[model samples]
Target: MQDKIYFIELNEDKKYEDYKQYHSLLPLEKQQKIHKFRYDIDKKLSLIADLFIRFLICQNLKLNNKEITFEKNPFGKPYLLGNPEFHFNISHTRNAIAIGISGNPIGVDIEKIKCADLKIAKRFFSSNELEYILTNKEDSFFYEIWTKKEAYIKWDGRGLSIPLDSFDVTGGPIDKMLRMVTIHGYIISVCSRQDFNGAWCMELAEDSVPVCLQKIL
Candidate 1:
């Protein structure tokens, strides 16, 4: 199956009460998790990320929303309960959430572009990665590599147990499996066990969200 990668820009003006309408779609466990968040934005992120993936899974597997269940690996990566072949990963920043799904292992990350901190880069980035960022001296490049490393470890499925500095996302064999693009002041990166193709990243408008939720709601 072709890989699926999608991102939705969060509508800041919409209050948490507006998002609370979708709570019925969540299992008790997920609902409780959403309730634990102190801020409305955090609650919305938790709710939408959970429901969005479920919607995608149900659509791809032709399963009912009630039939879908989730379990996490030791590293905290979530997987479909009975669907071993289906792999997906999710990441969210202040205003966007991204999800990637495929028959093969898949991971994706999105981050809002901000001021670059070379110190953080020095601490977590490999020597070669630091050089590339420093050489170009661009925050965009910093986020470009940052998102890739985040996507790589998420794709690697070990989470932060694997050091970010240990791997180089700069051009190499591993880079071949990665794809990245910038949109609306944010950078997104996707990684797959197989090479990525053209325009794999899709931006979902806020208006289409209700339509997606309806499938599983």
Candidate 2:
């Protein structure tokens, strides 16, 4: 299957009843983790990111959501329990959540656009990446590079065990596998072995989760 990406822009004032409805769909373990968060936004972000991927996989495979299970790699990247070949990654930033799923390994990240922090950039980014961000006048460049780097590491599935600054993403083989899009003041990056062409990066309404299920079915 082709790599698919989906994101939701959250409503800060969504009803508590709505939260409970979605929260109920998650596994008891995940629901407990969400309940542990002190703030509602934290709980919401955690809930949506987990549920977004779970429902998508369930729809794609035509399986019961409750039957699906997940296991982590040695590096701590999560994968479907029985369907080891299917790969997915989830990320959220503040008020938005994004998930990527593919027949092959995939990684995705979303970040709200904000003022670029050169200090963090200098610490985490490679020299070439730093120069690329500094050369570009727009703040979006920082997030563009930042998200790409994040997506790459997640795609690699080694997580932070691999150093962020050890590799350059500005213009290397890794750049070829990355696809990026910005929507509603947020930047998203997706990485996969597949060619970048024709991959869908779609914005989903809060109530429209089932729309994708119908289409995929």
Candidate 3:
């Protein structure tokens, strides 16, 4: 992804109060969800995901935190209510968060580099998709397809109701619009109607001012 997906990396050691403040800005339902996570990582990830969406919306629409409103589609796809022209999606890994926005529907995903369960892939990936994964870079290949499939489903907005095995991950009309970026050793993928020109930068949640984030690749 080149310019539409904006990223924010948060320091877990940063003041908890700041995160709490941002979490409070979210709707009561989201704040409750964040509060229910038993593990610190889960809680932070949830909070940051909400914060990323709120921060991006506030910045782009020039609105206050309270002014932002969201409503999910019948399929559970959340969207900007007041401004339907803008489309967005949010994703988070254990350490970082990503948000994408565009004039058309969009989806994004970030997965930390890790172990493989080829068995799961075997069940979910098509024969051709599995062929591509088994013959290529192994784990990297698996994640490449994994992230792409994830972004595609998010873009589709039907969630897991769409059978993952039904789509070809190797390449297709959907893959044409997808792009990937490797940052901090994680695989980041995005889907959009047009060519992706996502703005990727390391904007820390605490940084008050928005600046181009370097050291992200």
Candidate 4:
């Protein structure tokens, strides 16, 4: 099977609008059950993100009226029910979103760069990694390193519970097919078991349309 990872960049403003539509689609009970937060915006955004993911999965899998159910692993990683053959992962930051798909396991992460203390690098990066950042002579470089580390951790399926410093990706390019793309001040990475040797970055624009997959490969 040919394994390919596609990147989707959501319009922050448009996503909020889409979230509103999603809220209307949910049953009242389901909405109330999931929207435990006191803040209405937070509740709606959470529900909308979930709905958007489900819609993407349904479209990708070409399921006609068949609901997609997710099963959580022991480590809290979520996978599709009864479809172990197809694997996927998702990550979203304040202004960006990413979805990773493969015939085998895959992980993806996207993060928006914001002001952060440089000292935090010592906690998640190896001594060599920290030293490299110091030598790079740019203050913002730490956030780049942080995003890459977090993406790897998410890819590992252990989430933030795993120590970021334990694994080192300092050698050469992290992965031959791994694509690193940036938009609207955010960094995104997608990792998969198959090689994406010539993949090009695609953005999810307000006017852009979604692709229809014949099947999940």
Check candidate 3 and list the clashing pairs: 2-197, 2-198, 3-197, 3-198, 3-199, 4-197, 4-198
> Against the true structure, candidate 4 has what lDDT?
0.61
Off by over 4 Å in 3: 1-3, 15-18, 198-217
lDDT of 4 at 198: 59
Q: Model 3, range 1-217, lDDT digits (tens) per residue?
A: 1247766666767644455534556778988877788877778777667666676676677667777788998889899888977799988887777778877888888887788789989999989988898888558788888888999999999978899999885777877978888777778888877665434434445353123111110
Q: Which regions in candidate 4 have their CA more than 4 angstroms from the true location?
A: 1-21, 24-30, 37-45, 172-178, 206-217
lDDT of each: 0.87, 0.83, 0.74, 0.61
lDDT of 2 at 189: 94
Give the per-residue lDDT digits (tens) of candidate 2, residues 38-155.
Answer: 8888887787688778777877787777777888999999999988767899999898998988888898999999998889899999999999988986899999998999999999
Per-candidate TM equals: 0.96, 0.92, 0.87, 0.76
Name the lDDT value of residue 186 in candidate 1.
89
- Number of clashing pairs per prediction, in order: 0, 0, 7, 0
Task: Show the colliding residue pairs in model 4.
Answer: none
Off by over 4 Å in 1: none
Model 4 TM-score is 0.76
lDDT of 4 by residue, 89-177 (tens): 77765545566667767777677766756678777688877887888866556666776776666667788788778766565555443
Residue lDDT tens for model 1, 1-217: 5687888898888777886678988888879888998998888887888888888888888899889988989999888999998899999988788989988887788999999988999999999999999999889999999999998888888999998888999978779888888889989998887666777778987667878898776
